[model samples]
Target chain A: MPPRKPASKDPEPLPRSARKDLTRAKLLQAALTLMGEGRSFTSLGLREIAREAGLVPNAFYRHFRNTDELGLVLVEDVGITLRRLLREARKMDVAPRDMLRRSVSVYLEYVKLNRLQFLFISSERSGGSRILRLAIRNDVTHFTNEMAQDFRIRGLYAQLPTASLQMVCGMIVMTMLAAATDVLDLPPDQPLLEAEMSENFVQQLKIILFGATRLNDALTRS
Target chain B: MPPRKPASKDPEPLPRSARKDLTRAKLLQAALTLMGEGRSFTSLGLREIAREAGLVPNAFYRHFRNTDELGLVLVEDVGITLRRLLREARKMDVAPRDMLRRSVSVYLEYVKLNRLQFLFISSERSGGSRILRLAIRNDVTHFTNEMAQDFRIRGLYAQLPTASLQMVCGMIVMTMLAAATDVLDLPPDQPLLEAEMSENFVQQLKIILFGATRLNDALTRS
Candidate 1:
């Protein structure tokens, strides 16, 4: 989140793989930087991305075959970012009285910390190339499945059937993505509005969780 | 929904207002057509849209000052379509079993019926111009408020606080929009998949509804 650590600060020559990783990261950052500057992913050209990355155009081919290939890598990064957020949330104290609210706070912080990635996913998830949209959808499904798995592993909503639990997680993920959109668009330096949105977000997730429990109860009774 | 009824079938001279309305509709349709062809709203130019609408560039100004204004009008149309869906859902027999499923069915049908409009909003909502993004967000909020109001008027979720009720509706609206994106992307003639998606949709909405009730109980006890 803090600009990611540089691969190295010393002048000592790094391993070949390390250098490749750094250049790959640079190309990815170049793409995100362009998108951050109001360019849609589809509008980006490989030459410009390479130029932005301070590499020759030929360097672009060392990483991606085309812009769409680069776009897919960005989507993959979004997937990783999402999984990281989930991992962070999993680290929170589940016994806390307001764990949900705390989780929302943590999630918003991560969203802000990784604003460009969230913005990229939010915009592309519903609005861009078919390949990218489907890719984002697949990652979202993965996220929702991981969430459902977490709930089960924690014995939360354990009574719900697998199908119902997944549905509930899907709803939760939808709410989270919607909140991310809000987080990305949030006006800078507006704590009051930010708090209000966070509270609203927590309440929305509560509705899904409680609703899943209620459904499980009804199924058990019937 | 059935392509909208023709204003007249007669050979008589049309009223001036009627002609103006028809031309405006053409311009709106042209914009949608362009977006449906995978063009982002921000990328559309006045000349291209006018040409697409079979009008001179001058006629474009008669309907919209620029493409952004036209985009705003499209957002307005999306609002109307959403409200109409709500109205249709209201007419459903609430006492019947699985009313949520019925509503989702009707809603998905509407989404498919107005595929272009849904596609327009889905893309522009967060992906394009700031103006269009904000406009769509405003309409979505309006749709959420209207949903909350309808619940209140009908005595649904009668016990939840107004703020909580609105938040619940916001979740529900969020789910609906997410489902719309699914609906818009659904492959042609896959009834099995469509039904599966519809069932998933109903389950998601039910979770929110039941969740809201559970929260209301908790709040009351607290």
Candidate 2:
């Protein structure tokens, strides 16, 4: 075989814009990695994050004005990522029961695969950053609104008040988040333990769903 | 008016043990105050805490070996305070519906009254301290176990498996904690807003209880 032409030299060196984007992504991932080790974003230093990203401290400013700014961006990214996955799960053409099971499975898988992102989210949900906390709360409210709309579309609780629907959706979201935190907090080597937690989480979710449906029926009839 | 003997010159100085206890309480309260301001325990310095408590840095060692030790003590204290309040609420003689309404009200009121303690617990939950996180988790588990026993005694969900009961208890606890955090995170001047949030929280709890009861009946029938 020919020598492959030295992989085309620089392979058309990345454009300035793309290079900037790459650096920003690297910085965000580095922060995520540090946060995943249990340090809150407030405790994390800008220099440390820049070092972790293999960039100088000054380069950090090219992406974010400060750590809080970076944290806000991370919060937005996590919110978008989570909402997109859940929305896709809701879009699947499956039976209601299977949809729920699949949705939860996907969510847990995402939490496991994006350990750093989820860790950043869970920690910051009530961590030291006020802006991040509010950002998460807004995302939760937005997610709840989206879930309420999906339920309305499906006619799952057609007679229930909109507020009631929001309440139910909020509970489900909070439960799923709590479960994700619990699973991630477990020792990484404990696959068996993690599986058990996953099963328990599903059971808990089923119980809540069963209860919510029954309540909706009762309310409509009364 | 009598001079009252100038209030006695000695004034019966506090006993040594009482003085020690007061100092410990002061230190803990200082930590709580700092954590309440959106700072995680891991971000807190011993000297800062000591200063807040109006003591020298070296004096902090008299109460705790290090910040983690102080944090562990704080976790235990918070757990005890929470468990006691919940136990008292559970002991009230009222209908099931009233019981839940009253319990949540009491819980929220406690959160308001002990804002600092709740803030500490909320922050440390997923904070950087592994030991503190585990301590909180164990307290939660213990609290759930106690609730399960109480449910059994009350003839609630009598036919459900213990694990299922635990799941229910865990959900309730998580919901209450989330609610507490929400209330505390709100601006201090929002009385009207706080009341509205309280009402919404009550409604959400009612829905969960309604669903749990229906599930219990169904499980019994099946």
Candidate 3:
């Protein structure tokens, strides 16, 4: 058979740096796929991940020295994802007219949009992997701190002292994570269940905000 | 060597039903032990659990048809544990002074006493095994409902309607579960970190209670 001619529609090969980035992303996606399939983060093997990425075992080393490093990078990616979320939240109007419900809607949509990554973090955050658990915990604490900073910047809960505000933010963050478990586990196409869950989520956050507003006064009275 | 003889302090054998109960408990405990070791509930096997319990595989078959069945039983046990905790909380004085702190201290101590069980539930509640996840979720729902009932009986949050009261209890239960993750992971013998964590836990519960009290008014205005 004669040699096949190249298709004119084919684009030029990407540059070396860009191709490397593509391969790195492939490895990360492979890990997420495995985790999204319900495998614990601690149980993942490097060779298996490389195979899943359709690359040679040696290629895995080019992107990450080991699985733990890859795990850390995944967590770092989660940190960025959370920061981006906070940034989106900042863009929303701070006027408290049904703001909590709107934020919950946006956040739940985000959780569904990035379902696999959230699955990985939630499972590994408390799973058997000490390294992953601690890394995820660090990211959560950073997220909580940024939330407190956001509240300060927006002048919400202004009466709360810095420590008290931080504590309140921590509770809010915990509530968000807890709601995520339900959000991730929710069955598909069940609008009624989804509404009930969202309503519950909204009420929970409202309670926390109201609690923060009264805590300072209550402490003073005591 | 001379034939082995029963020790002088050895008591008579337990009845057959009691002996069966002992083996059943052992099998349940073996699952918790494996989960506490970082193995996902979905990854545990019947033979492996039986071996961990120092029992024959047949003994495991007598107790549970599969690992998932054993997992459901463990979830049921958690329900009983939660009920016992509520009973103890009920016994505490109904006065408002420092009650939240006292309840938190008792709950944290209870978590420490049942570290492996909490580890199993926390890890499996959102982990790979769908069956175990659902079962744990059910038990948690039961715990939340019972908490609401107790609140009604005790006249706490008396003005709130039943539906609102139940939602408040759900949020409280979620907070308790989140705190369990931290309490289970806490490093041993660190008084400072433990106190700090416990204080944060108290603040979170306080916020929830305060939020519950004012939620009705907030809703009416809206």
Best model per lDDT: 1
**Chain B only: TM-score of model 1:** 0.87
TM-score pick, better of 1 and 3? 3
lDDT tens digits, residue span B155-189, model 1: 88788889998998888887888888887778779
- Report the number of the highest-TM-score candidate: 2
Worst ten in a row by lDDT for model 1 chain B:
B1-10
What lDDT would each prediction earn against the true structure? 0.85, 0.83, 0.84
| Candidate 1 residue pairs in clash (backbone atoms < 3 Å) | none
Which 10-residue span in candidate 3 chain B carries the lowest summed lDDT? B1-10
- The DockQ for candidate 2, computed on C-alphas, is 0.59
The better candidate by lDDT, 2 or 3, is 3
- Give lDDT tens digits, candidate 2, residues B117-149: 888878778766788888988887888889888
Q: Summarize candidate 2's per-residue lDDT along A91-196 as a digit string, tens digits.
A: 6845865666676777888888878877887887887777888897788788888888988988887878898888888888888888889878888878898878
CA shift of A145, model 1, Å: 1.2
Instruction: Sort candidate 1 into its docking category.
Output: medium
What's the DockQ for every one of the candidates? 0.57, 0.59, 0.55
